[model samples]
Target: MRKQHIKSHPVASLYVENQSWLRGWLYRKVGCTHLAADLVQDTFERLLKRESYGDVEKSGAYLKTTARNLVIDHWRRKALEAAYMEALHIQGEAYHPSPEEQHMHLDLLNRIDQVVQRLPVQTRQVFLRVQLEGWGYAKVAESLGISVSTVKRHLKAALLECCFYCE
Candidate 1:
């Protein structure tokens, strides 16, 4: 009966039995209750999705290392996000804009969208290719089977129209 039960049961039960030890191990290493809880949850989540492990004897060791790596990754991502937010905050402080300036920028972007919508099909295609898709003039010209000069002309027309409407 014991053998049959072990065979029928999921490894998830083993994880549940070890959860407290896993949390304690993680907390000791990470020194943060929240971080340890998060890592413990993620470790189990990965275990659930993983395929059959031939050598189940190493589960605990593997889980511990995986939890540590996850903690490292979390710290790295947090640092990157912090740096990005700091940069954005500094830029915001450096370039203070009046409410009118903000409104004007939004208005110009809307008008540019309207102008692009009004353009001829070919002109709109060329503009979207170069500006929105980040394609080079040569690439756009080759793809559309048009001369590079024609590509340039369409781009100029689109820009002029957008600027005229924006102002």
Candidate 2:
């Protein structure tokens, strides 16, 4: 039965049905076959890690949305890597880290990115404006139209998230 097939090999069937078009879509967006292929795999891998991924509707829209997020994540990681390398270059060869340290730093950056990405939208906005942009709590609260106490709450939650992930 068709139901039996899906129950037995849900992801494999989904992949067989959607992989080619999804790869094509990614290639059109990123302009690279290799990167597109890589992102396609990443998207499905992300689905497999979900506890109830099998409950996802057998729909193109869901798959497309997942692939789009992977593309956004890929772009973000690339930008982070470029900025990091630029910072290191500015420090000159005399300040260059050992290769192992450099790898560790980049990996840490990626993990931090993941933690930030997991934050809720308002919490992320508060955390970013305060921490990343150096805005005071009142300033960030005014800009976001949230109360200062709310801003502090969000920052506390964000800090707790970071601490939880650090270990």
Note the Cα lDDT for every prediction shown: 0.78, 0.89
Over 80-166, each residue of candidate 2 has an lDDT whose tens digit, in order, gives 999999999999987999989988988888887888889999999999999889999999999999899999999999989987896
State the lDDT of candidate 1 residue by residue for 1-167, as single tens digits. 98777655566565767779989988987889888898999987776677875454346877777788777767655655566456556898777667677556545555566688789998999999999899999999999999999999999999999877776
Q: Which ten residues in a row have the lowest lDDT in candidate 1?
A: 76-85
Pairs that collide, model 2? none
Candidate 2, superposed: residue stretches over 4 Å from native: 1-8, 52-57, 141-151
lDDT of 1 at 53: 52
lDDT of 2 at 152: 99
Best by TM-score: 2
- TM per model? 0.48, 0.78
At residue 62, candidate 1 shows an lDDT of: 71
